[model samples]
Target: KPMTNYQIPQNTLLKFRIFNEFLMANERHVAKEVRDEYVDTMSKIYYSYFKGYSSRLTKLQYEEAAARDDLMGVEDTAKKGFFSSKPHMKNRSTVFTLGNRGEVLTTELEAPVIVPHAAAKNETRYSFECIFRSLHFALMDNCCREFLFISDFFMVSGAGSQNLFEAIMGKTLTLFLKLMEDSVQDCYDSIGIFLSAHIVYRYQSIMTKRNIPALDRYWDTILNHLWPRFEYIVTMNIQSVRECEPNKLGHIDNRPHYITRRFAEFSAAIVGISTTYPNDRVNRVLGQLQAEVENFILKMAAEFPHRKEQLIFLINNYDMMLSVLVERTTDDSKESEMYR
Candidate 1:
């Protein structure tokens, strides 16, 4: 994660360049055999560095994920958003979105038991942020520089250098993407993937500033790759709620329903994440989700036998949902104050 402060290797490529230059300066022969040996040695350097780095990066992600208690808990934490985590650049102008104050909605509003929706409860996760940071460090930051180095060193065309780089180092990129795809395909929590996309998108600005036009397609490809899966997950969630028949359950509880909590938590989580990094497309999705949740609440409220009971139940459930969002308030903002 650009989310975590995990350090990545720096200046390691510079050392490789120094060694290559040193070898070239000291070489005693320029015969075919000598040139072939030199090229072979350089090939090993590129291949070994990238392959080794890729494995380490992937391993680090697994380790961090396992340390988390569970995927559901992770999603719960994310719902509050990461605004307080501090932005990457404090120098950039900052704007804060205020959150509503959670009213005293309960005579005893202890932690509402989160009866999680029917989703996989994975013990560990392959963090999207970790994958994003690691692969990005290797490809855009590390491999980009290394590829340029190979081109200049061997006097190969940029295209040829790309092929050479892929032949040796492409396995790492493939592995990273495959891992991301597999993780997202079977993700227990989507908020992580959702926020991670923003991380990838932000790289566009970095790529522009660095002026590496050739590599822009790589990140774009990544976003395109995960996008469909993300949308599918979001769609499945909305569809589930849309098609749900709350009337079938022949029970009425004055307390908040599990589905209600799921919706509330989901809404709050995305709002929190989006508050820090707002996207129109994501907001549109949130809007749809919010609408479904409201409808669901109305339907759920109708389950109660009495009009007063139905009204009270709706209030309780709405308060339950509102409390989740309100607790995630930012310290400086004018927006929520108007509604608060």
Candidate 2:
């Protein structure tokens, strides 16, 4: 039967919890072998739950098509000692309530809702927000269940449960992060990049608060993808200013030159991107690019036939830059001071 991409985690958790309830109730009476079987069962459930739920994800590597039969091998074991609470659904494949249990894991969705990194082969549709949204939402949505898996059910502390959890989830998780990284390299839109980075930043804070350290590295991996591409775009912009053709510098007119207008827009955007990100290393990267742009502006100014004309070019353009920069900045004052 067709299902949503999200069908896996919740169903997996529900079924696992049925068994968990059984285990917790009878844990003291159960033998060590039984306990190990419970742990093994829960791990396999999670393995199926987090395993590539997205169609595009499987097509690629953490990416390709797996059996995706939703705990296919583990069902018979789940049914081993557990009896059904619900006999009516015996004909249905989902059979919850083993006299009370929990799934095939994930379903093949009728529509592939997730945006593929490049499988769509259309850059516009694969906006950073689209891919990031699908992955991060799915990732964080399961954290509560994950915490439960570790704390309430598994009863393991420190890294025991977390390590195991990451082990099962890490391959797909890392693949998406890597996908986002590669996807970001092709993104030229600052707003999309800014929004995606912002999501990761806030998601990291949320994970930290929830004490889910398993996702910390993944969040960092996402930011790592975002910032470098941002710097690349910034560098590309600065390079435009630096590479202005002297012969094509064109005569200084009564208005700011076309490049000047473009720079003002770029300045507003770059600073806007940097201000929210607030990392020293990234700030420095943009700062150096700004410096290069300033030096080139001077060089461009020198191309003017008259000193007064040079003043016109510099003063008007500088005024435009200052206006946009000042408007974009605030008293809270994030990002590099070097741009000012």
Candidate 3:
């Protein structure tokens, strides 16, 4: 059966719409606090969706599991009920016996459910495969925030967990690289593929430095191979798109924004700026800024003079707060702040 496409919650969708509207609006300024609040809510929504999606395996997963079991010749002994208990050879203790007829009774033992080794192996393989597939789709689906959250959690939980995660990440990257080649052959967005791959690779390289030192060597090799190949593929893809959609090529967004570099950059930039780090002082400052302002750039660009003054006041106050927290003796002049 085809899996039903689970609809994202209506309220979440509404908030997303409003967020995009506010973020992209040219005429009106959205406050920084408003933007941050919306983003927080959006993060929660995406997390909820990711959790739900991971918890329930799709029909494809079930099919794959069954196929794997069949290939492995895995049998469930409990399901077959093919068990017989044997009595002790000596039959040490006998039941009551009569003079004419004697009868010995033995208690029947129940067979415990036994899982075949092959079956257990198949289960483990299926679980890992499903997780990789889910993450792959999640990345492509623009649920990268959720992917980052899950992957980070998995990496730090324990040594065994980290090893399993890195292994699967490697496998997933290899598969994606293969797919990227196929996509290029089919005249798809080769540059986009390279870009996304590099982004993921860079992040994985950074995040796994402490846990998987060997992966750095592997990454060096991959990057060396990727550079020249990426250049060639990107050039070819550009020419192809240019020839195919002459007038609609370059800056023109013929289809959805998904095919454009600007959209990808914008989305990534938002995540980078909005995401909180582990550092206590930085988190506190960023959190405060997010709480106070509704829209940073919009206010700067607003026509109203008072709005500009408000932005200045906010910045000065923020700088003063930061200076006190850091206990730095540096000048807090507007010029210095702007340069910094």
Candidate 1: C-alpha lDDT: 0.53
Clash numbers, per candidate: 3, 17, 8
List candidate 2 stretches off by more than 4 Å.
1-126, 188-191, 249-254, 273-277, 331-340
lDDT of 2 by residue, 1-340 (tens): 2124444654575566567666666775563455466446655654464454554543432211111121111223233324645322122213111111000011211123464555556532333354455556666756545655555555567687677666556655755666676667755554456556776776677677777777777787778778777666655555655665655544446355555455555545545545545667556765665676567567778877799988887887677767666776553444223335
Return the candidate ranking by TM-score, descending. 2, 1, 3
Clashing pairs in 3: 30-295, 31-294, 31-295, 32-293, 32-294, 32-295, 33-293, 33-294
Whose TM-score is greatest here?
2
lDDT of 1 by residue, 1-340 (tens): 1211211222444455555556556753533344466446645664565555555455434332211222211222333325765322222111111122111111211222111121114332234454455455445665556556556554456577667556545555666567667766654335546655666665566667755444565677777766665566666667766766777655668888766776666666566655645767766766676677678778888777799999888878877766766766453322223224
What's the distance in Å from true for residue 73, model 3?
55
In terms of TM-score, how similar is model 3 to the real structure?
0.22
Q: lDDT scores for all predictions?
A: 0.53, 0.54, 0.33
Q: Mark the regions of model 1 whose C-alpha exceeds 4 Å error after superposition.
A: 1-128, 147-175, 329-340
Superior by lDDT: candidate 1 or candidate 3 = 1
Best-to-worst lDDT order? 2, 1, 3
What does the lDDT read for residue 289 in candidate 1? 66
Better of 1 and 3 by TM-score: 1
After TM-score superposition, what is the CA distance of residue 102 in candidate 3 from its true location, in Å?
85
The Cα error of candidate 1 at residue 242, in Å, is 2.3
lDDT of 2 at 37: 62
